[model samples]
Every structure is written in C-alpha cells, then in structure tokens.
Target: MAVYTHLGSERLAELIASYDVGELVSAKGIAEGISNSNWLIETTGRDGTGARYVLTMYERRIDVTDLPFFLGLLDHLAAEGCAVPATIHDRDGAACREVEGKAVALIEFLPGVSPSEPSPAQAHSAGRALARVHLAGTRYPHTRQNPLTAENSAGILARFSESRLAGIDPDLPATAARASDIARQMLGGLPESIIHSDLFPDNVLMLGDEVSGLIDFYFAANGAMAYDLAVTHAAWAFDPRGETIDAAVGRALVAGYESVRPLSAEERAALPLLAQAGCLRFVASRTEDWFDTPGDALVRRKDPMEFARRLEFYRDAGQGAFA
Candidate 1:
C-alpha cells in the first residue's frame, strides 16, 4: 500500500481554497488504487452549487523527478483529444503542489465505471486507445530506463533465490530462475518507446461498452511497444481458468491497433517473449508484496500464481497463439 501522510480534511480544504477552487463541501478517502492516497473532493460554489474533483497525495515509492514526465504526457494526450484525466492547475499554474511535505494534485473527475471483464469489442477499442497514446507520446522529451530491465530481474532473482515456501507451492524459486533466463535473453532485442506498462481492465474506465478513459500513470515509462501490447494481451485475454487465451480477442485487439499504426516484423517476433516478461514482472512483484508486506495493510496483494499460470500458458502455446 502507498504510505500516506494523511493530511486531515481541514488542511485539505485550506489547500483547495488556496487554489481558489471555492470551499470544500466534503472530502473522503477513495478506496481504490494501491500507489497513492486518493480522495474525492466536493467543493461548494458561492451560488450553492458544487463540483467534484479527485485529489491525490503522491506516494513516496516513486521518484518525484518522474512526476513532470507523467503529468506532461497526460497534458499532451488530453490536448491531443485523448480521453484522460485533466490535471487541475494551481493558482500559479502549477500542476503539482506541496502540502505537508508531500506532492498533491487535483484532477477533473472522469465519469465512468470500471468494467469487471471487458467484451472482445471493448478490448479492441482499448487496444486502439493504447496505440493512440503510444503514438502521441513517442516524441515526449522525458526518457527513463524501464525499471523492469534484466539487471533488475537478476537482482530480484538473487534476493528471492533462497525462498522455498513463498506461495501456494514451494517451487517459486525455480520458476523465478527460469523467468530470469527468459528475461535476460529477450531484454536486448525489443524496440523501445513510452509505454503504459500497466494497462489492466481496472485501470480502464468504460462508459457502456466503450472505453471512456485510462488512468494510473504510475507505471508509465519508456519501454517496448510490443511489451505494451503483451501487457494488454495478458490483461484482456486471460480468464480465471488459465486455459487458452481467446484468439478472437487477440485478433480484435490487433486489428484495432493496426488501424492506427502497424506492427513491425521484429515486434511481432518479440511479442511472445514480451508477454512472458510481463507475466514474470507481475509475478515477482506480487510475490514480494504478498510475502514481505504486513497483513494489516490496506492494500491486498494479488495471487502470484495467477500470473505464474498465465506465464505457463504462454510458454506452452508458443508464438502460434499470438499469430
């Protein structure tokens, strides 16, 4: 869970007033999101009207230096007619502000419900939206090395090598070793660009069957475009049974994406490995968070086996599944 400094509602109201956004009528913690302490802020107008805004107290887990890039990308995408959160600037026109020694920002509250399981058509639309974001963000000035590099994988593997009974079964260490090898082999061959590394269903908000907006830029960074597609595939195609991924779903998604920008042969070749890498990254992080974090925390760690099962499915099916 994100470590929250938890400024009380009184202080929050003061902060909002400083932005000249009227009086805070109500403020309460939002239960979703693991990376930051989010709150729904309702402000009262002088004419007895009100408006809603999302207020976020940024977490310490991510480097503050990356905030500009994340915010800048959102601004650029919003300006370019992408459906994304619009950052509310402060009185001095700053997108972020310091409050109680933590960075806080307000954004226009997007209206929609997060789909539990998107249909094939919804998945296709999401794929196209993601491609649009990638195309728009390619020339963004900020660049950072993807934290999921081979070196980082090796480091994590070394740290977790000795674990025996980390999860449902006792073979997690061996699985980690195999994943590390695959990651090392694939890391150098893939094409790189700005990617929304976590494009899961929960991060996508839908208005009816259409995707209305995308959220959660905490994991955004410069990475491979194929890796981004692999991430989305892992998220959108997999079901609870861990059986075969739906080919129709894959086709729809790819068709939607190619409608905007086509994929290269190299990217196509690397898609399987990229999908495996996405699985391993999630597995490693989930395992670490599951075992290392205290049980009393607000954040509930997901089952690492879910990702492990997805990895196994991709490995067994090979590149034919993607084709």
Candidate 2:
C-alpha cells in the first residue's frame, strides 16, 4: 500500500529494459511496505528464461546519499554468506539508476512468506540471523550513523506534543522520559557495530521453520549491539496490548543470539533499560508520524500507544522483564 508515486506501463517497461536481467513480462505493486514504492517485477531472458525481481523506487524520508551504504551492505552480507536479498546490477554495471528523478534498484526476489504468527523456533532463528549479521557487518566498509540516540530522543521529546501522548496515557510522556534517562546512561556503554536497526518481524522472510532472508536495510546503522537485540525482542515478543512479552520466545531469541556472539556482562545488565529504549524510540517516531504525515500519503500510521504500553511493562517488571 506504499505506492505513492505511480508509474505508467511504458515507463515501467523502459526502466526494466535498462537492466540485463531480462525483458519485463509483468509488474505488480507490493503493498506491504511503508517506506518506499516497491514492485514485484517479472522478466524473461532472450532464451525464454524467466526470473523474478523487486524494483524499489526510493522515496522521501530516505536519504539519496545513504543508498550506497545500504545497497553495499547487502552485497557485503551476501558475500559473508548471510541470508540476505541480493541486489542485481543493471546492464551498465550499475547497482542503481535514476528514474523519474528517484533512485531505483533491482533486488533479487527472495521467495518465502513472512510469518504472521511466529513460533518460538522462528524467533530463535531471527535472533541467530541478527547476531550473524552483526558479526559480518563488522567487516563492512561503509558505516551509517545512528541518529536515534538517547540524547536526540530526549531533545525530541522536550518539544514533543504532550497532548498527543496524553491521548495514549496521561503519564506516558513521563514514562518515556524516565526510560530515555535510563537508556542515556547505559546504551552508550555497550559494544557498537553496524546493525540492521529495523529487524521487525515483517522484514524477516521465513521458508517454513527457517529464515530465508531479511529485507529492509534503509534503517541499518552503527549502534549498540544490545540495543539492536532489544529492538527485536520488543518487536517479536510483544502482544498487541503490550501487556506481556512471550517468555519462551524472548528466551529463545537471546539464547539463539548468544549461541553466535556471546553477550558481555554490560550488555546483559543493560537489557531492561535497552528494552525500554527500544519501546521509547518506536513511541517517539510513531507519535511524530501519527501527527506529521500528510493525511493523503499512501502510508499506514501505526498506533504509538502500543509502545507506550510496552514502556510501562518494562518499567513495572524491572530487571526480570525480558527474563
């Protein structure tokens, strides 16, 4: 449903022809993403060879300057044997092309369905993949700086629309401030690396019980490795009301991650605050989007209060929250 700028058929065909992958047979708009305009493109080779690929037209809110780092990380991770979608270079040996003044690229179509209701095993695999990605990302040359640090969050919240938060809960802003304080003190002390900062469930493609690939690297950046894990724990383990995180699934995630790269004592001790930081981040961003995004934009705004409830849960449970 994120098809903001629609293209004519003639234009689409011309763009596909720019690539050596094949001739364009059919193209369908993929409606699941919120960041960019994506199309599932089908092509055929000169010898009647058919192939599937995804064409992404980068939209606003995504920096054109950061495209190299994002796409380059995909190439790097694939080289490292990670389960990642590969980018297909065009005929002129270019990974990206300008179409209608927008940056566009063709990516190999990874086949699998993202689980609607993930099992414990699936959670474990996701964690395992994240850890492996962190390990591999160490060798990546380019770095994307994380702008969503605790200090920035505090500054954003200072000018935040307090009344909007009161709609979620009168005390939600206070809760966020406390969590931000905790995060500021601890998040900076953990191990840092370039991480897939947006590893939500929808980004994880599963082929049965195993992880097939992870999509969406636009949010990838250098950050605390534990904060990245905490982000996943918030995403994969929480229920709709955010009343509780699934104990078994959360344990599985941490366990699976530990199996790949062991967590330092600092990282482990910072888990609770880090979890709060994760929720605080989503709440802040979602709140901004909930109000700032134009009403006519072809995007869905998630409820910010869901993370508010999560922040409250972590605060109430304290150290044993994720345990």
Highest TM-score against the true fold, candidate: 2
For candidate 2, what's the RMSD? 2.0
lDDT of 2 by residue, 1-323 (tens): 56878888889999988888778899999885666899999989546679999899998789999999999989899989999988988889888899989999899889888887788899999999999999999899888889887666666666666676676568766765674476556645578888887788899999997899999988899888898998898888888667767888888888899999999988988887888778878877877777787757766568777887887777688767767
The whole-model lDDT of each prediction reads: 0.77, 0.83
Residues 122-216, model 1: lDDT tens digits: 87888888888888778677877778754465556566545443544565565676766776678564656689999888998888877798998
Off by over 4 Å in 1: 1-5, 44-50, 162-168, 187-190, 241-244, 294-299
Inter-residue clash pairs, candidate 2: 1-31
Q: Please name the candidate that would achieve the greatest lDDT relative to the true structure.
A: 2
Q: What is the lDDT of residue 257 in candidate 1?
A: 78
Tell me the alpha-carbon RMSD of every candidate: 2.6, 2.0
Worst 10 residues of 1 by lDDT: 160-169
Per-residue lDDT value at 282 in model 2: 81
Candidate 2 deviant stretches above 4 angstroms: 293-300
